[model samples]
Target chain A: MTTEHGAVKTGDVVARVEDLHVHFSVSRSAPVRAVDGVSLEVRRGETLGLVGESGSGKSTTGLALLRLVDATGGRVEVGGQDVTDWSRRRVRSLRRRVSMVFQDPAASLDPRLTVGASITEPLIVHDLAASRDARRSRVAELLEMVGLRADMADRRPHEMSGGQKQRVGIARALAGEPDLIVLDEPIASLDLSVQAQIMNLLRGLQEQLGLTYLFISHDLAAVEHMSDRVAVMYLGRIVETGTPEQIYRNPAHPYTAALLSAVPTADPEAERRRRRITLHGDVPSPVNPPSGCRFRTRCPAARDNCATTDPELYEVEPGHRAACLYAVEAVEEMRAGAATTP
Target chain B: MSEPVLSIENLSVSFSSRRGVARVVDGVDWEVHPGQTLAVVGESGSGKSMTVLAATGLSPRGAKVGGTVRLRGEDLGAMSEVERRRARGRHVGFVYQDPMTSLNPVMPVGRQVTEASEEHLGLRGDDARSRAVELLDMVGIPSPEQRVDNYPHQFSGGMRQRVVIAMALANDPELLIADEATTALDVTTQAQILELVESLQERLGTAVVWITHDLGVVAGIADQVAVMYGGRILEHGTVDHIFGSPGHPYTQALLAARPQPGVRADRLATIPGAPPVPHQLPPGCAFYPRCPVRGDERCRTEEPPLTEIAPGHRVRTFYRAPHSGIERPAS
Candidate 1:
């Protein structure tokens, strides 16, 4: 697990999940297998980006990591402690180790509370501050740390813009000084420029505080940029995991290739020449996912083998793995074919 | 080139409030030719939507709309309310971002679309129904005859959007206005929608005004691009010129801020402040406060007129800084 700057050591795992599953029984219908048998790890001081489209269980996985959603089956170990089925008392201790920045800042923060109150709420919950003054000053310090002015702390969430409310959300997430932070689509709804601001802030904070992040989003471009390691999820399963270069430059999975090609770039000439792999259908429902390989229905290179036997994640390169039979050769062929298409 | 399908001269939209009048779309001018797609790119509240709404007489009541909107040389501004509505329905079509809200939940998808065809195209009952099905099939909805009777909720997000596109194209107007139509869908689904629109435009020869904040989508389909900020277009150019050598600093920053798939940066090129509020926009250049390369007092004291910087490329700025990457800090 050698990284660019050697900031993340190979074995220093901050959080780990083993064969996790989260099922929901909605409207008395069949159980929805939102997160089905997924497992991954977040190394200390490195961001692991979880990306997928809607109903792919990326958000559910993020919630399960902090025990906000009960684990139907499997174990979640954070900071070397099993927290899968932690009691209320045990979960409180887990909260001190793990905090989350929700997708919608407006809904996450209490509308009635001031920004200062919201930022200090976590500190007071875990009793991290010795005194009210200590908590107050820490709130101010956090505001400054997230590049917000101290005076804005007195304003409520409605008084600020979306970007400012997100800043408050980050300040609150940092109040506990957790070892790991789970950011669930933090910039999905923000504008392009504001999204850039938040991404820059997240990167800077991770570097400065040595904090590990499990950044989850459907935005593939953002996930690629922010993640030290990228995990592509499809219908509640991790289809591929690798470094940005491996995932973006030489994607092993057909799904990853389709996603990369789907994202239209800012260069017009390149777009004109780009041969898009147009996936013809919507994401199949997770309740009744495809029988064998989940993406077999949409996978262009799917075969008879894909329908009966589920392929586990296989290593294609150092620190890179994909759960597809044609990941190695077909993807290379497709890449070469695309480059010379026009 | 053939006559422009839609042209607006000095178009502006303002709403009166207790505080004062909030001018959202301020003195905007643009033209969309038949069979060409013009992308209006902007952040939220940048008046991209308002410009189209006002030009097509869809803005909210009590809002003040100024300037002339001419579609096919017909003065839409001088038309009476009923005449304006008829002209808009017959000549212009609209598709919004969220298909669920724009579509009727209780109405069957078939009926919802045929209503537009019946009202605008004047096709009778059987004619409207069959035309609706054909339009749905054209938008790539499978088994359109069977699925036409299903409610909007029965359809998936992408299919619902396809239905919306069907509704937009049922009348086969000369112009189609899609405001953030594909922004809500997944990347793959967005690609499908973009391709669908491109093919439809090719077949029907309808002009398109695509309003979105995603430059990637702009690069993919737009013939010309307009970058909007603070309810005004800051830059306008052909897609090649805009992507190749963006003439404005804001345009440059917007391009730099996009997180490319293979590109990694420790810090994204940040534009420091949020877009100026409509009511509180600065007197001169609306983007001056957040501009990386500051223009002199001329930019501060007076608004810069749109100046042609290249063939078919215009920039609204006094500063002629190099179109370098968005690394220089916001002034």
Candidate 2:
């Protein structure tokens, strides 16, 4: 699936995963099926938001693509090249095509290293810059791209604020000039006001550099704003996939609907008027997930069929799919209900 | 309105640090009536938590606490240390962000729940056990009698929070303080907890002080909101007033900065510059550096008082806030 000269044309699939699985073996216990039979496609120059709660395996799926975690089964293709079974040594070249921005920037960066060195390390490792002077200039350019001052290059991680550290992290990720970036909860640690700043910088950088993003965050509102399309993950599977409009407006899966309804809008009037669906019981242990449907234990719309049969992704509309037996009916009912509402 | 369940006046908390005196909660004043919920909203270091800590007599060691805190019309400042501690357990209850930290890991859930009842209500043995089960059942914990024996680790994150809530209500305190109680749970679980708290509040008529950084949560749960910045209350008003007709630049910027559930925009409205540190706070308005609307030079040199712009609404800024049809009365 390698493109000519590693050049992925616009609208091409920059990264694709087919039935990917990442399982960790826990001693004296059942293996944790972190990423079980997941499939996704991230297109060139588009941000695909991965929205999920904790223990949903979204981060594991992202790590699987970067070969940080080994895929126990299935295939992963990044930049049109299959890296599913690639060793750590062979995976180094793949890093040049894909990079990651972690949730905590302070943890991701070295406290001792200057911001410039942190950004330049990737360039040196990837051999993107030929000389030391070239690396220095490239580091400055990368910092400027992330809305940080060139003078910030000399500052240490502890010397900067949370937002500034995140900017440095983004600069380091951009240093590799990767075709795709997996932003795993990039703005989760920053303050509310600073979150907007980092988000805007990311969007601007994406537009300027034509970088594809796999934006992973638990914040549903943020995912809706940034993604052209969104995939809702529950337990270890992608339960729903659609454009932000379709997914947020008319969620086909019950889990998606419950998650959406749970988020209170910033407006008081709307929040008070909105109908909230409270799920009974907590999420089942991932080690021993509920039979058939993983969300059946807590789903408000669960039926006998949900407990008996494992559902697969079924198309509720063009480019919109949900892994529920009642997807088609649910979508139709929601749409009809919405149309009738005053 | 009936008498306030908890009233704080000119509450100030400062710690003597190596760098300087860090005035964390500076002259905060508010009141919460019975069955009312006041959300103290702010980012980290904004002193929302410090204000609550000082009011509850839980301020850290070597910290100076000034002003009066009245619980159920009794002044806390005048009470002795032992009296204040006893009053805190009987009149006020707390639930923090992490349930693990609040609950005793080694103790049975029922034992932890019964401790408050035993100490505050003088319920002993069977009476305490029955009360524990009853409280747990009220919090929607299924099979309360059986689950009461379980330890904190046995229950899930959401269920643990439920147990914590049950314990908080064990003493039947008139005031409850939940500081980011549901922030750690999943959205579905958070919804369940929020519903549980709301229902409990309704049934028990407990006034609640909800301290959080999430504006959306504030909109859903709060009757009144106090926006804090750099250890000062920039704005205090009803939820409608704060969200619909903000009278402070900081409040307006925060409302605009947050990404609403349904609205999608190319770029979010942002407040430039970082929030101020407590020690280095400027003498003028705390939000002046990041405020989008700075009216005049006076705002940079003098701290404006919290002046009422409307009945039950106040803004601490020299800039004339756009009040629409309602005119600001001269202060």
Candidate 3:
């Protein structure tokens, strides 16, 4: 490691995961490793984007952090305190400091409850505000903070548009004054114009409140636009971790490179000129992921060693790391080679 | 080109809701030539889905459909419900957004495919089952014989989509309407699906009308692109023409809105506000409120018709006229 840990140490760490593993019983002899042996940290006032394909353990890792799902093995530390084996009462207390925004806002919000009630329920549950007047004032403030009219809060979830509902969900997550929020594909369901609005809202709120976010998504472009740092996940493991610029411009892992290329470019001329690194085969079952590097099956640079020995995440550049032996060597080779062609 | 495999002219679809009479699709004109992909690109509720749904006579009850839809020179507007139903499966295939909903959850994958084949082609028993397996194999589903018996829930998302494709191709219709087919899939699976659609179109010579909001999906696959905004075709032209020399401000804004990978632009050029609803559309240009180049007073009062900008490219915008101050690039 390059010891850029010093830079990360300067900031207050809001959430940290140590060797988290979440497994589900698939059959009598098999267990699906939804999230296996993952370790990460989210700093206060920072956005950590979790990028991955479906069945890649990205969502499971987010859920594990919130204790929404049972963790098979792991230590979840929020605000420098370990809540790994907390009592039910302690867990409820910890939830006040942390909140989560689900993928589909329409599905997440209670259809029967009005938007105002849905948002204020968290405040009531956490006992953050005692009086009805206090709760109502807080709800109105949250709605205004998320760029929604306070008057519309009386409407039910079905009455509002998709973007409006998502804003309400964000308002609900913010009600508890959380230090960290887990956003799982928050803007995936919204249209492009609405997605931009949500992204801007989230960015503005982060700056204003100094809140941390564990942003999970499959869209690389959106991830790059929002996150300060990103961790690429595959088969329940963090395959690569780097800043947004590093991940997009100089991808160290083959899977990351392929994923970056897979996102379609808006510039037609550039789109035609760029060569996409199309991967073969579908994502393998989490129950029986391939040995060693789980992405080796679809990795274009996979070698014989990739099948036997699992690569440890090593720093290819300052603060940029990848779990691929070949990636490190490839980076060295590219460094040695001259600027021969465009 | 020869007569289009599917031609829709002046098509208007209206629905009587409790609110009022909502004109979802208004005076739309579109065509699909054999082996060509015509992409109908628009945001949700822009009438893209309703327009196509009306074309196959599959609109919901009480939906009023007008204008002429000619498939192989036969008028679909004049056809009876029963005749339209028979013509739909035999001559036109439809692929919905959610394959899980389109495919039966209880029925086996093979049986579902065979049902479409048997219903449209009258193949029965062993022949239908054999054709179903062949269709599965054609769609690149592995182990067609054993995997065919698996239920919809048993298959993965991509595999389930493949099964849906097989069912769509069972009748081998001349025209295929894929409404947001790859929207639910991931990037890699989406690329595969697009490639499959392209290769199959080449082999079968079937014209495809792909409806989606994702510009990337239409980038390489579509031969012709029709940009719809506020229930109107704002721009229609060859893919290269639209991508390189867009005429309408709405189309330009859409192109600028999408963020490209590896390109770190400071801010995305966004057209603020959502598309207006069918009943609440503004006078003249429905996009005037969000149009970046809205200047002339006529744009606020006079509705522009689809005027030819090039040999093939057409745009419905008063801002792109001869002396409208917006210079047209040499075609």
| Steric clash count of candidate 1 | 0
lDDT of 2 by residue, B94-143 (tens): 99999999999999999899898788779998888888889889999999
TM-score, one value per model: 0.96, 0.95, 0.92
Which residue pairs in candidate 2 collide? none
lDDT of 1 by residue, B28-147 (tens): 989999999999999988999999999898899988999999988899978899998888888788899999988989999998887877887779878878888898899999999998
lDDT of 1 at A55: 89
Each prediction's Cα lDDT score?
Answer: 0.88, 0.88, 0.84
Best by DockQ: 1
Reference A-B contact fraction recovered by candidate 1 = 0.90
- Our tally of clashes for model 3 stands at 0
| Candidate 2: tens digits of C-alpha lDDT, residues A101-216 | 99999999999999999998988888899998898899888988888889899999998889999999999888888989999999998999899999999999988989999999
Q: Give lDDT tens digits, candidate 1, residues A16-113.
A: 88788899988889999999988888888889999999988999998988899988988888888889978988898798789999889999999999
Clashes of each: 0, 0, 0
lDDT of 3 by residue, A1-342 (tens): 232122567248888887888999866979999998888889888899999998889999888777787788978888888888888888887888889998899999999999999998899889988899998899999999998999977999988888889999999999989999999999999887678778878888998899899999998888998888999998999988999999888889877877776776554555556566666778988889899888889876678988999887888888788989798554334333312322
The DockQ value obtained for model 3 is 0.40
Clashing pairs in 3: none
Give stretches of model 3 more than 4 Å off.
Answer: A1-7, A26-29, A328-342, B294-301, B320-331
lDDT of 3 by residue, B1-331 (tens): 7889889999998888788878888899989999999999998888999889888888888989898999888998788878888888888877877899888899889999878668778899888888888998998888898888899998878888888988888899899999999888888887777778878999999999999988877777788999887788999998877787888888887776666555556567677777788877788887888888886788888888999989889999988522221122455
Chain A vs. true chain A, TM-score per model, equals: 0.94, 0.93, 0.93
TM-score result, candidate 2:
0.95
